[model samples]
Target: MATIKITTESVAALTKSAVPNKTTFYFDNELAGFGLYRTTTGTGTYFAEFRPVAGGSKKRLKLGRVGTLKANEAREAARRAIANAALGKDLAQNRSDERASLTVEELVSKYIEEYVAEHKKASTAGLYRMLLKKHVKPRLGSIKATSLTRVDVQRAHALMTREARVSANRAIKLLSAAYGWGSRHGHVQEGMNPASGIKLNEEEGRERFLTTAEMLAIGNAMIEAETIGLPVDAGTTKHAPKGQLVVMSPYATAAIRLLMLTGARLREILNLRWSEVDLERGVLRLPDSKTGKKTVFLPTAAVDIIKGLTKLGSYMIAGESAGTKHEKPRSDLKRPWAAICKRAGVNGVRIHDLRHTFASTGVGDQMGLPVIGTLLGHADPSTTQRYAHLADEAARRAVEAIGGKIAAAMNGGK
Candidate 1:
């Protein structure tokens, strides 16, 4: 075992290395006796090791697994264990008591309060809560945390899969996380995550992308929507006078343009603030993205789009009627996007498809996958590897072009 300052980045970096033949251990520098052991397969389990008495052998208390509990959370667990040990408390009996009569529902509540609320983003926490309440609680909530078998988990997953295949997978993921947290924190026995090693539902990738012609149509439609406006739906116009048209906000049009120009996620562009935009540096410095802090380099076209847009309040994409005392960013561009797509004669294309269109355009142009990945702010290279086939297609086209020239020369320039 090696002693070092443990951090989230350092622990994550371990996954990049080759797996060991046996379990390896690393301890925290700040908190001695608090460490994590990595199995031969690369999974790590946090633990607190200390002598139960002054002259007695040291005992190791398992805290939680890596990926489920962050390094800080593990450290906190180690601290609590040390404090309890100092008070002459029996750690083993306390752990047994903690696990006694604990149900899946109770574990879910504890996980949300102690772990999810403190560690997860608000959006992610809300999604977790929804998954637990709607799917997991309905099926497996009554089961004892220690007694939840893999078969029970499978049954719940199957039931949810019959209704929403994707959500079923996500709910199982959350349940697994809760069980893992429970085990680590002594609410359940170690290695009792029933949701583990289960196969998730096969989900088809939604990778819709626009062609050049389709992109042109969208651009023209944006212009039209901003100018003449699209016709209001009969259902919506029922509450209004006749002949009222729905005009797309300039901010909405600009937001769409940015989405196409920059291969950013919808929320990244929608929730962007003025302070985050560094026009001189040509980058958007996001403090907190889905993958933590990220800097999005702006291309010339994207920069031009931003330059042309007038800042309405603090946010680049202002909500309805800016300049109010209580201003907020636009929640979504659903209506504007739908209206523009309808006018463009494009059907079944989501706003997110614009991001795909941007990425595909780059891939089609033979930009290197690493370069494209960097522009898209993909932390993992494997994520960029999704476009590997697209890169092969580009290579095939290049070879064909070269062959065509040779054929033309062979045929006397025919």
Candidate 2:
């Protein structure tokens, strides 16, 4: 029988000379469940040996090795096990139960119903649902939430990144949040969030802005497409094939121009109705937006586009007037926008990028971010901080001017 002192000093001082054979156990004096177990092969490890407070067979679990764990570290691990045993908790069994029941789809559904629907904004909840349905559900939804690993999260992100990088990150973000939600609600064991430490795909923030030349080209393309019609492709000019011919309605052209002039999102402009346009106030008072009730300060250029629309029905861009097919306002300008992009040689550009260009133009003109944020109707100043790059140039210009003045003053009229 091995003597049982089990202190750092005592365990370190124990000699191999007293070894009998087989294995030996040395229980701790201060910490009840902590002990040292060694085999005849000279292998030794720290362990926690305890019977349940609910009355069952005692279980022994290895904590760590003597040399690698240090006596203090091993004791701390043993203390945690002893604490769990006293509480009648079996960590291993709980993990098994979680693995059997908790799945990615189940956890996401629970998160949306219990947390998102009640707490998050309606628009946010909708976006989360869409992201899960399109990106997450089809990929990792069937996997056990507890069995989820960092590799699995990374793989799912990789699959979507080839199509759209931002979309991939959003899906990853939702999964991460859902896992945390699961942990809090006891749907899964705590600290079992695989999405927590997973490496998300590196997303290059798209800051594409139309140059003056490019803008001129787009302007000419819009005119040609609306009036004379243009080829759907680059090389197919005057003698284009039958399917290669495309044209943008004057109304659709105006909508695309408004996107370039105002920093409002796609839905904000597409779903815009005649009632929302306040020609007298010169502001588009959107009753609801992603950021809640917001107002977009329409520049003269944007105002011209809205005023030019015929107001065929309830919408500014309504086609077919009072027809039932076009009653709910123009839902999309996808085809027109694509034709415009192709004609202008601005291929690979998304309609959303036009919003970025709007902000970029404001920044280049030496506008403050707060003022731009107000123009964009950002609810938070920090939300407008992404445009801080434009502010940096203005700051540099101001500093240079001030430094020049100070140098001239200090030169003593030299």
Which tens-of-lDDT digit does each residue in 106-145 have in candidate 1?
8988898798999888768878888888998889998888
Q: List the residue pairs that clash in candidate 1.
A: 63-184
- lDDT per model vs. reference: 0.84, 0.78
User: On a 0 to 100 scale, what is the lDDT of residue 117 in model 1?
Assistant: 91
For model 1, the stretches where C-alpha displacement exceeds 4 angstroms are 1-103, 116-123, 138-149, 234-244, 320-328, 403-414
Best by lDDT: 1
* Weakest ten-residue segment in model 1 by summed lDDT: 234-243
Model 2, poorest ten-residue lDDT window? 231-240
Off by over 4 Å in 2: 1-102, 232-244, 319-331, 392-414
Tens digits of lDDT, candidate 2, 1-414: 554767777777663446648788888878887888877767677888888888978887666666656788788778888898889887446645865787799889789888999998776888899988998889999998878889888888889788778888888888889877776445776446777766677756677778888888889888988787776554333345755655657778888888888888877887777889997888888898878899988888788778777757777766644446637656577777776767787766788888878887887778889888888888899978888977898789878988988888899745
